[model samples]
Target: MRRPVLATLIAAAAASALLAGCGAPAAGDAASAAGTEPGSATTPAVAGEITVLAAASLTEAFTTLGRQFEAAHPGASITFSFGPSSGLATQITEGAPVDVFASASTATMDDVVAAGAAAAPAVFADNVMEIAVPASNPAGVTALADLARPEVKVALCQPAVPCGAGAASVLAAAGLTVTPVTLEADVKATLTKVVLGEVDAGVVYATDVLAAGDTVTGIEIPADVNAATSYPIASLAASKNPHLAKAFVDYVLSGDGASVLTAAGFRRP
Candidate 1:
């Protein structure tokens, strides 16, 4: 018989189990059900932990995903180290205890693949760039072209990040050069500038704006600019819980994960 359920928030923790040398591939999928191990019952506390190093832009969606994973598989703990994809890659190369590395840019993951720190990575979701403006619209910025004005204080991520690269593409396609007041290390930082009213305008992923929940208004850039963004995830070479890692990664591409990402305004890759 199924045990009585508790007050689990679904996105709270992760479930870890011991089943060496068995089961299906869970790479790039983050959603796994309880009893993933052989003969394992849906126990209240399976007791396992998986560490994930992800890009800064994925902070919200992944956090939601984490909570869901924890709820589905009770007794599991998921720890995340979210930051710029490049920084995460460097940490992995330097031998961090990272079971999964989800990069905002393929180039960053290439570094991990080059150093043999992670297995083959896969692109899971795609994001499009948008104009993030203050909730009050103090600058009167309405369109992508408006960002070219002198009075608009803009912000963009450092060029090493995926969102930054996409921002450059958008500017070049429109033949516009924005003198951003700040070049943040990650997309989330850039978005924060607009949300905090520190900048009149900024560029960020469409998903970022949605995740912010009305803290900022988003204007669609161009479809071509959207063409350049992608999110890739992989399993690290040094993992104590690889089976669980794969389960999480695989969940990322499943229908449940796709729905969460879509609701957050990210497109399927």
Candidate 2:
């Protein structure tokens, strides 16, 4: 009887050991199944998409900055909407799903702020007007005065845009008034007219001229007569991704982003 009882006890112990071996995972298996290494510190994932509405003048610089921002914050993406600052402001006011707004002029940003579409906007950069002419300079436009030539076809941004207002100010400061053949919607459109030879000359932002490279020749406007437009950036109040929007605004104001903008001919504000 004692022998039989001992054998039964040994059999029970063996069965319990087999169950334990089957239930427990092998070393490192637990971590692998959990999608992390053993003893590794966990980090919060940074992921989301934010849409930004920016002025046309900021196209090149902002595009570069947006790429850098995405690289720095893995899993984050940015979609940009570029147009005249005034048009962008109106879009935001009309309930556009924009996470951020970067304007070519403070006045345009003020409009968004006044409409409760954006919060306190910070001036990020400044840009001045430059005379953009075709590479061939068909109308022989070499200075601000040259744009007044009767035969010269000049293009200027619409008055509703910051570029247009700046152009008006520069022309006013020079005491010169010349009718434009076309009123473009934005600085890029004005530059395009000059680049495509649709117009002999255009008044556009200095940055736009720089972005055009050799496609268009830029005649520097006299500092005294040139109108400097202050660029302001802010996260919109209607942002779906408020945190990501604010992060993008902060990134734009960072040193790395400033370096990119400065390289693109934007002056530090």
Candidate 3:
């Protein structure tokens, strides 16, 4: 009887040990169950504020991307300064405390990189010149050649701006020369002239015309005569929040960013 009682106690102890071993998970097993590999480093949550200086032509797309980035990164925020690429590049080179720079042309980006303000900019989009006119079609501008007519009052971005350079290239390709009535500082300002009927037509980006919706009508530039500029984005070297700045640049090169840009009529590079 004593032996049987001892055996029963031993059996009960054995069963309890088995149950404990099967029920409790090991540290590595717990990590696996949570869909993480054991001993692997996890990405830290992005948190901080960044200032982005972008080309005026990228206003609509970049604004939408900025909102999406803020939504995805709850603790992160972005402030944007949109203007001519050349001016924005100058600001970065002049120590404006910018976090990121997205220029409408490679040449403008090169200026920042040359100044050591940025590095290895990625070209994300390309834009072509187009003729933006008021919805009323007051000038009856139908083709690129119409912009050359003596009676047509045209607005253009300043020569230093990407839109102006593109317009110049397009006109040169078509062998048409017509001076602009107004030389605006940025693409948006030039577009405004067309939208407000202050000018019969404005030489701006195709994306600008699309963003204008019904307020302006776009006359397509022939592919052979059209000029396109590549957009490059980079994290500035003097960023106070370097990590956040790089994250923002990465976000702009992401698929989600491409979608917003495409919706805004920017062609993927």
Candidate 4:
């Protein structure tokens, strides 16, 4: 009787131990399942697609920066819509789905801000007006005054665009009044007219001339009469991914972005 009772007690003790072991996983297994130990530092995942509305003048530089930004933030992507800043601002006000807004002029950005579509913007860069002519130099445009020649078929951006405003300011300062053969919607279009030889010359941003490379020749504008346009960037208030939108804006203001902008002939703000 004593031996039977002792065997029963031993079996009960073994069963209890087995049950306790089954209640919890091994330490290594627990750590592996969690993918991190307690108190460990982990980076938050940044993954999403953002749409950026940028000025036509930023086409080259922003495209390069967008690629670099995607490379840095794995699983993140950027889509760009490039056009006149005024047009973009209008779109944003009308409920366009844009994550970021980068304008070539503060006035254009101000309109977005006034519409409550964007927050207070930060100036990212500045650009000055330059005269772009066909490589053939059809009108023999060598100076700013050459654009004022009656025979020169000059293409200028529409008055609503930043490039046009800058051109107007510069012309006003130089005390020159000459009608343009064509008024383009944006700087890129103005540059295109010169590239296609449709116009003798076009007033465009300095960066636009650099972006054209050998396609067009750039004539420097004298500092005394030249006008600079400020580029401002902001995260739209209606952004679906607000955090990512702000991050992209920060990236543009970062040192790496500055290097890219400088390489494309933009002046740092």
Candidate 5:
């Protein structure tokens, strides 16, 4: 009778051990199922795509910075729409799904801020107007006054654009008048006319001339007569990726970004 009781106890112990072994997951497996490593917590990756509406003058620098941003955050990416600041501002107010806006001037940015499309923007850079002529300079243009010659064909941005406004200011300061052969939608368009020799010269930002490299020659306006514009950046209020948008903005304001901008011939604020 004692041996029979002992056998039954042994059988019960074996059954209990089997159930315990089969019922519960191992500690490592439980941790993994909970989305963590057994001994460490994981950080959420900075991952998402964002669209940035930037001034045409920022094309080169911003493109470089965007690449850097993506490389720094493995799962993140950026798409850029480069255009006149005024047009971009209008797009933002019209509910375009842009994550960030980088304006060539404060006035254009103010329009967005006033519309509640964006908040207070930080000025990141300053740029002055320059006269970009074709490499050949067919009109023999040398000074700002040369643009005033009635025979010279000139290209200017539309009045609504920041580059246009800056050019206007510089002309006004110098007490000179110029009639452009064509009014372009943006600085790049104006520069293109000069590059293609469609116009004798184009009034554009100094940075635009720098970007053109060997394709164009830049004539500097006198400091006393030159006009400058401030570049401001903001994250749009309706951004689908707000965190990533803000990160890009902050990155532009960082030292790393400053170096790139400086290399691109932009003046820091």
Candidate 6:
């Protein structure tokens, strides 16, 4: 990261009419009024299909949850679209057929909430940044500060994405300057660059390294540079089946979803 950061805005593509970009609830009273106890309402399996748009980082975890939800609610078929949080928000706001949305950052979530396309979104988990490098450790990056050295070729996520934004905060705190070969659109892409040795080092989530296991090695970041990123989930206000959407959101907030996300490297929000 440099003294001044460039902000990138991602755009959504044309999807099915049922699919628009994600939007947030109305301000003040409407937001509060929309908030409800998870699973408080009856969540019968009302059917067409339940589509979920989530951040790219949640790909693995949500895929697992989607399977479990399908098994539990046999008639319900689920579809998922994962990418940068900003991109997902754009799709949802554009009227994507998203019944639910799970964002990697609150800022992105706020965009959806403010658009009045979603009910109040509740934060479920938080994630922190880490350095993902090849198992060989050729560059010998030991801490957040080391990326500043001119010899290091780093790859960071785009600022609009959660990991990219966290990297900015950490690098600023470390007083480091990184001339990265590129800034990726999402965290997984950055991690992939490290796994492929396309870059000497890349910033990602601690959980991603854990999931990759032997594929990549993780270097710890200083506690201060560890900015906890919040993940928020909500039922879309444009939902065709808000009742089922609410139930799915409840499942994600329940012990079942937490178990999967935590095991994958997310912390309680």
> Residue by residue across 142-209, what tens digits does model 4's lDDT show?
99998788999999999999999999999999999979999999999999999999999999999999
| Residue ranges of candidate 4 with Cα displaced over 4 Å | 1-44
Error of 1 at 73 (Å): 1.3
lDDT of each: 0.83, 0.90, 0.91, 0.92, 0.92, 0.84
Between candidates 3 and 6, which one is better according to TM-score? 3
Candidate 2 local lDDT, 1-269, one digit each (tens): 36688899999999999998999987577766765566652522345998999999999999999999999888799999999999999989999899999999898888888999888899999989999899999888889998887899999999989999999999999999899999999988889888999999999988889999999998999998989989999998888888788889999999998999999999998
lDDT of 1 by residue, 1-269 (tens): 65445534332332323232145535323123443443444323334898999998888889999899889878678999889888888888999888999988888888899999987899988878888998998999998989999988999988877778889889988888888889999988998899899999989888888888788988888675444567889988898887778878988878899888888788888
lDDT of 3 at 256: 88
lDDT of 6 at 243: 69
Between candidates 5 and 6, the TM-score winner = 5
Tell how far residue 233 is off in model 3, in angstroms.
0.5
lDDT of 5 by residue, 1-269 (tens): 36688899999999999998898878888777765678554523457999999999999999999999999988899999999999899999999999999999898999999999999799999999999999999999999999999999999999989988998998999999898889999999999999999999999999999999999999999999999899999999999988789989999999999999999999999
Better of 3 and 5 by lDDT: 5
Task: State in Å the error of residue 136, model 6.
Answer: 1.1
Highest TM-score model number:
3
Candidate 4 lDDT at 217 equals 97
User: lDDT of model 1 at residue 266?
Assistant: 80
Question: TM-score of predicted model 4?
Answer: 0.85
Clashes of 4: 0
Q: Show where candidate 2 strays beyond 4 Å.
A: 1-45
Worst 10 residues of 5 by lDDT: 38-47
For model 5, state the Cα shift of residue 117 in Å. Answer: 1.3
Cα RMSD, each candidate = 14.2, 6.1, 3.5, 5.3, 5.6, 22.3
Residues 1-269, candidate 6, lDDT per residue (tens digit)? 43323222122233332253334333444444544334433334444588899888898999999889888887678888888999889998998878999999999999898999886889999998888889997899887777888888899999888889999988888777787889999998998999999888998988888888998989988897677789999999888877678878898999999999999999987
